[model samples]
Target chain A: EPEVTQTPSHQVTQMGQEVILRCVPISNHLYFYWYRQILGQKVEFLVSFYNNEISEKSEIFDDQFSVERPDGSNFTLKIRSTKLEDSAMYFCASNAEGDRYEQYFGPGTRLTVT
Target chain B: GESVGLHLPTLSVQEGDNSIINCAYSNSASDYFIWYKQESGKGPQFIIDIRSNMDKRQGQRVTVLLNKTVKHLSLQIAATQPGDSAVYFCAEIGAGGYNKLIFGAGTRLAVHP
Candidate 1:
C-alpha cells in the first residue's frame, strides 16, 4: 500500500535556528495536514494545506510556522525560530477527500531543539 | 470549542482476551470518528472509522461503535495478541470546512502473554 513518507526521521537543531520538516504525501492525495505530538501529550493539529494555500491553522501554528508544497510531491513545514517548546514529533498526513475519510500518517519526524 | 477524551489511561489484558477502548467527545457537531493505533517510535496507524450516520462499523478483527446521542465511541478488538499492545487514540472531525481532526489523550493497551 502507498503511504506518506517523511524525510530526516529525526532532527536536532539549535534554539533560534530554522528547521524545515519535509513530507511526501501519497501521490494522489489532495488534502495535506501537519500535526505535532508533544511527549506525553495528545496529537495537536497545526495546519492544513490544499491548492497551495492554507485552509486552516491552529493557535499553535503561529508566525514562526509556514507550510509549502515546494513541489508536486513535497509538502514541508518550516519553523523560522525554533523554540524549546517546539521540540516534538511532527507528523504529516494526507487524504483523497477533505472530510470523513481516513487520513494516512507518515512515520513522523522527531524534532529536538536545544 | 471541541475536546475528545478517553475513558481510561491504561488497560491491561491477557492474550486471547477481548479489548475495548472507550472515548467521549464534547462536540455534538462532530460527524466523523476514527481510532488509531501507535506503537512506540511509529506514527499513528488507521484502525477503523465510522460516520455519524452509522452506529457500527467493522473491519478485520476490529469493530468500531459510535453513539451519537451520548457522543461516545469505542473500538473493540477480538482475541487480542501481544502485537495489539499500543497506544490507542480516538479522533473526531467536526462539521464544517477543512475537517480538522481533534485527538483524544489516548489509552495505552497492554496485552500480556
Candidate 2:
C-alpha cells in the first residue's frame, strides 16, 4: 500500500535557526495537513494546505510557521525561527478528495532544537 | 473548544483476552471518528473508522462502537495478542471545511503473555 513519507527522520537545529521539514504525501491525494506532538502530550494540529493555500491553522501555527507545496509531491513546513518549545514530532498527513474522513499519516520527523 | 479524551491512561491484559478501549468527545458537530494505533517510534496507523450515521462497524478482529447520545466511542479487540500492545488514540473530524483530525490523549495498551 502507498504511504506518506517524510525526509530527515531526525533533525537537530540550534535555537533561532530556520528549519524545513519535508514530506511527500500519498500521490493523488488533494488535501495535506501538518500536526505536532510534544513529548508526552497529545498531538496538536498545526495547519492544513489545499490548492496551494492554507485552509486553517491553529494558534501554534503563528507567523514563524509556513507550509509550501513547492512541487507536485513535496509538502514542506518551514519554521522561520526555532524555539526550545518547538521541539517535537512533526507529522504530515493526506487524504483523497473523496475520502476526507480517513487521513493517512507519515512516520513523522522528530525535530530537536537546542 | 472541542476535546477528545480517553477513559483510561493504561490497560494491561493477558494474551488471548479481549481488550476494550474507550473514548469520549465533547464535540457534537464531529461527524466522523477514527481509531489509530501508534507503536513506539512510529506514526499513527489507521485501524477503523465510523461515521455518525452508523452506530457500529467491524473490521478484522476489531470493532468500533459509537454512542452519539453520550458522545462516546469504544474500540474492542478480540483475542488480543502481544503484538497488539501499543498506544491507541481516538480522533474526530468535525463538520467543517478542512478535515483536520483532533486526536485524544491516547491510551496505552499492554498485553502480557
Candidate 3:
C-alpha cells in the first residue's frame, strides 16, 4: 500500500526559529492535509490543501503557519516563527477524494520547540 | 457543529478479549466516520471507516458501527492482542466540504497478556 511519508521524523528548534516539515503523499492521492497533536492532547486540524490552494484551516492555523506544494509530490509546512507551544507531532495525511475513502496518515514529524 | 467525543478515556483489556471503543458525534450531517490508532510516538493509523448511509462496516478484525439517530459510533476489535495497545481516535467528515473531519479526544487502549 502506498503511504504518506514525512521527513525529519524528529525536529529540534529554538523559539522564534523557522522550521519546515515536508511530506510526500501517495502518488495518486488528490487531497492533502496537516494536523498537530500536543502531547497527551487531542489531535487538532491545521489545514487542508487541494489543487495547490488551501481549502480550509482551523483556528490553530495562524499567520505563522503556511503550506505549499512545491512539486508534484512534495508538500511542505513552514512555521515562520516557532513557539514552545508548537512542540508536538505534526502529521500529514491524504485521501483519494472527498469523504469517500479513509485518509491515510504519515509516520509524523515530531517538532520539538525549545 | 463538529465535535466528536469519546465516552471513556481509557480501557484495559486482556489478551483474547474483545475491545470496544465508543464515540459520539453531534453533527448529524456527518456522513463519513473513521477510526484511527496512534502509537506513543507515531501518527494516526487508519483502522476502519463507515459512511452514514451504512449502519455497520467490518474489516479484518475491526468493526465500525454508526447510529445516525443518536449520532454515536463504536469500534469493536476482536481478539485483542498486546500489540493492539494504543490511543484510538474517531474522526468524522461532513458531506459538503473535505475539511469536515472532527476528531475525538481519543481513548487509550491497553491490552495486557
User: Scored by CA lDDT, what does every candidate get?
Assistant: 0.94, 0.94, 0.90
Model 2 DockQ, alpha carbons vs. true complex: 0.87
The residue-by-residue lDDT of candidate 1 on B1-113, one tens digit each, is 79999999999999999999999999988888899999999899989999899999999999999988998999999999999999999999855578688999999999999
**Clash statistics: count for each candidate:** 0, 0, 0
Comparing to the true complex, what docking class would candidate 3 get?
A: medium
Pitting candidate 1 against candidate 3, the one with the higher DockQ is 1
Which portions of model 1 miss their true places by more than 4 Å? Answer: A98-100
- Candidate number with greatest TM-score: 2
lDDT of 1 at A88: 100
What are the candidates' individual DockQ scores? 0.82, 0.87, 0.69
Candidate 3, B1-113: lDDT as tens digits: 67999999999999999999999999877888899999887789989888789999999989999889899999999999999999999998754586546789999999999
Error of 2 at A84 (Å): 0.3
Taking every candidate in turn, the Cα RMSD to the unseen true structure, in Å, is 1.2, 0.9, 1.5
**lDDT order of candidates, top first:** 2, 1, 3
For candidate 1, write residues A1-96 as lDDT tens digits: 999999899999999999999999999999999999999999999998988999999999999999999889999999999999999999999999
Interface RMSD of 2: 0.8
Residue A11's C-alpha lDDT in candidate 1? 99
Q: In candidate 2, what are the lDDT values of residues A1-114, reduced to their tens digit?
A: 999999899999999999999999999999999999999888888999998999999889999999999989999999999999999999999999998778899999999999
Instruction: Give the TM-score of chain A, superposed on the true chain A, for all candidates in the order listed.
Output: 0.97, 0.99, 0.96
Clashing pairs in 3: none
